[model samples]
Target chain A: MLKIHGIARSRAFRCIWAAEEAGLPYEVVPLGFAPGFKLERPLAINPNNKIPALEDGDLVLFESLAINLHIAAKAGAPLMPTGDDASRVMQWTLWTGTEVEAHVMRWGYNAYIKPEAERIASEAAAGKEALDLRLAVLERELAQRPYLVGNGFTVADLNLACVLYGPWLNGYDLAPFPKVKAWLDTCLTRPAALRARKLREG
Target chain B: MLKIHGIARSRAFRCIWAAEEAGLPYEVVPLGFAPGFKLERPLAINPNNKIPALEDGDLVLFESLAINLHIAAKAGAPLMPTGDDASRVMQWTLWTGTEVEAHVMRWGYNAYIKPEAERIASEAAAGKEALDLRLAVLERELAQRPYLVGNGFTVADLNLACVLYGPWLNGYDLAPFPKVKAWLDTCLTRPAALRARKLREG
Candidate 1:
């Protein structure tokens, strides 16, 4: 059995969504946090001690996006693209990690996660401004295509949608980028994504 | 021939290095920054207006690491690992982007890029402290094996070596992590990397 070592509420949610999409049965090890939100202990599987490490027999792996890519590769086709489309998948995935995610997290933490008193309004506003610039790029791309790669849903959509999910659920308005909002809705409404959301909500 | 649409000084250096390693012929389209180091105009090839976009036939891709992955995929074999090792390559690449690169850049900018008057000693120290934690993880992994993936040099090593190149070149000492220093030396000294360095230097 494949084991994912992290809580559902963490970035591990991405791997869970990917596993669900790929129809890969996996167990969550429910690793929790120490005080101050640190990992409870150093993870042997991930020397960086971050959450969402995947264990597949002897092959232990870290990085949530990379784990999803591996799951897609293992499941093959539909989830993973072939030929140059594979590169497109990677392009969007890497783009989201570098360009979109940090801003999303900053906004999410201030808007949703942090205690109200600890939240910095300026930081959240700055994050949103940064996101507005990047979302315009995504909005343009989504206006041209139904999905991130090719015409079908793939791990790229899954990876990016999961990154946006936090802010979306916390009522971050997507009205500004209708195409992005529509595309994200199409991605999150999939049966697999719904199932993954159930695990997260629980 | 691949047309890499960025100068050698930007993150595009990674792609240039990867092309050299893969023995692929490529041309650089010099992209210059504006007065504040911002892109002078919105780039058509990359809506993000980022440097290091790769143009291959009809496919246009941004994100330097992703471009290198694509180049590796095109070249195949020794540069791009097969099977699960491909996942390992993705793993290290993503890990470096998320966990390592920003800190390296922070340290690099304060230590090397910014005029001395603009450099913040505390920020540089903080970046170094954060990098020390991450490098310890890398040091452990390198100590276990000479290369990042499998027994051979692959894109993972190439991706990470380039990220550290700025700090390493600016005299950030790697003496504390002897294994990481040795492995980086091995990677940077390759003929391909030297060729890429010449492009950067010239």
Candidate 2:
């Protein structure tokens, strides 16, 4: 049995979706229980003390994206890439964590988390600008291809899609990005994605 | 010829060090005028317009740690773990990006980048608090082991070290962290690490 730590409303959701997609049974260890709860035991597995810790037998790993990669790898399915592009897949995955994710979190924190009175317009604008820049790059890459890597979907596309979902749900429109919008549509069409939505709707 | 795009002081140093450590023959395509510039280049390799994009033949990769991992993969040296621990290695490497890197960047912005007048006491304290928490966790982790993964140095150590170095230079006393300080000593003891320091000095 595998154990996962973190609330579903977090980056951990992606890991849960990944585990479900892989048909692997997993236990969701709640990090936020009471009002102010956040990563207590989960931090033991990961020094960062964030969320989405995965424990498989004697091995424990943290970081949502890394957990997704681990599960995808163990399942041995469509989640991973083939041939020499394995590292390329890994490269894009980390890129999402750096470029897309960093910006998205900034925007989300400012626009939604911070009270309107406390939120700085410049910070929000910077977040928007940063996300826009990232989307534009995504638009270009996803324009010619169905996914981030190739004709078919891979883990890179899945992870990137999840990152984009943050800003989109936070009220940032994706209307201008045709390629990105279309790519999102394709990702949403996946059976696993539908299940991911159902799991996240709470 | 492999062309790595990034400035010296940026996370690109990871790639710079990795290539040198891997003995990968490549050229440095320095972006940003000097050190610590966060400007972006539009519609190119990096969407967010950041430094440290790696262009190897036709494949273009960005994100410093990712590029470093790609280089490490090719070199297949003792720098990274092999076989079963590979993904585990990836997990820790990404953890550095997710936790240590972001937290330390906050501290750096306060110390060096932010104008003294604009520097808020609260912001610095908040940043310091976050760094203290993360570093405490790191110190605890290091107390148990020599490196982040397995018994050897990997990109996990490299990425975290580079990101955390900024804070250390800004006067966060590392003397009390016997485990962390000892581990840092071991890491910097490497000839490659010594050479990387030279690059920084120059």
Candidate 3:
């Protein structure tokens, strides 16, 4: 059986959602960080010691976004696509990781996740400010299409949506980007995404 | 021919290197930023207004790493591989983007790129400190293998090496991780990489 190592509440959430979307059966190994942000235990599969590593028989893979792509490809699902669509999938996935994830993460931690006294107001505001410009780009793209890649839902949508989830849940306003807001709403309510959300937030 | 829309000095350096390594004929369209860190003009290819967007026929792609992967794949060379090796390529590509690029860029800017008056000492120090732990992970992996996947130079190495170029040039000291230093030396000295560097630096 395929095994995904890490808690659903972590980046493993994206992988779990992808697996569900691909209709692939998998188990969560529950690896995570201990106090002081160290891994709970050494993970031979990933020297980086970060979680959401995937074990598919003898092949081990790390990076939640990469893992989701592998899961989707293995299932031969539309979530991964092929040819030019696959290239588009990769484009959006990398863009989300490099451009969107960090800002959204900073905003989420300061705005909702951290203890009230520990939060940095400036950090939260800066994150939101950075996100505003990127959201405008997303708004333009989504205004033309319902999903990131080709017409149907794909891992691109899944990856980007999962990164945006933090901001959406933390009350980051989407009032200025109606197309992004509508696309995000549609993405978050997918049956597979809801199933993963249950595991993460239940 | 592929039209790479960006200056060689930007993230386009990675794509240029990849195209060279893949032995593909491509043109550089020379899109770049104006003062105030904005694109010199609007880029319909990338709504984010980032450079390093790729145009091949009617297909357009942004994200330097993703574009490199596409170039390598189109060439059908060892740099892209296929099957499991392709997955490993994606793994390392995403890992470099997520775990290494930002820290290295921050360190690079504060250490060398930024003018003395604009440099932030604390930012450079913090970036280096964070990189130390991640470098240990890279050291372990490099100690075990000459290359990231399937015993050859691939886009994985290309993607990662390009990201590390900033720090390497700024003298971030890879001495503590000899294996990483050795691997990086081999990667950066490749004729294709040298060609790209000439364009970027000249």
* TM-score for each model: 0.96, 0.86, 0.95
Task: Provide the fnat value for model 3, as a fraction from 0 to 1.
Answer: 0.86
Return the DockQ of model 1: 0.85
Q: Per-residue alpha-carbon lDDT of model 1 for A1-202, expressed as tens digits?
A: 7799887778898998999999988999877563345566667768887898999888899999999999999998889989888999898888878888889988888887999999999989999999989899999998898999989999999989999998778898789999999988899989999988888886
Give the Å error, residue A92, model 1: 0.9
Docking class of 3: high
lDDT of 1 by residue, B1-202 (tens): 9999887888888999999999999998777563334465877778888888999999998899999999999999889989889999999999888888889988888988899999999999999999989889999999888899999999999989999988777898788899999888899989999999998877
Would you give me the overall lDDT of model 2? 0.74
* Cand. 3 Cα-lDDT: 0.88
Chain A fold similarity by TM-score, each prediction: 0.95, 0.89, 0.94
Model 1 segments more than 4 A misplaced: A34-40, B34-40
lDDT of 2 by residue, B42-107 (tens): 727775567778888888877788878778878775776665577777787777776666667676
Model 3 per-residue lDDT tens digits across residues A1-202: 7799888778899999998999999999877753344465577767777788999998999999999888888887577888878888889999988999889988888998899999999999999999898999898888888888878999999999999987876689999999998888999999998999999878
DockQ list for all candidates: 0.85, 0.58, 0.82
Please tell me the TM-score of chain B in candidate 3 relative to the true structure's chain B: 0.95
After superposition, candidate 2 runs with Cα above 4 Å error:
A34-45, A109-126, B35-43, B113-122
Best by TM-score: 1
Model 2 per-residue lDDT at B107: 66
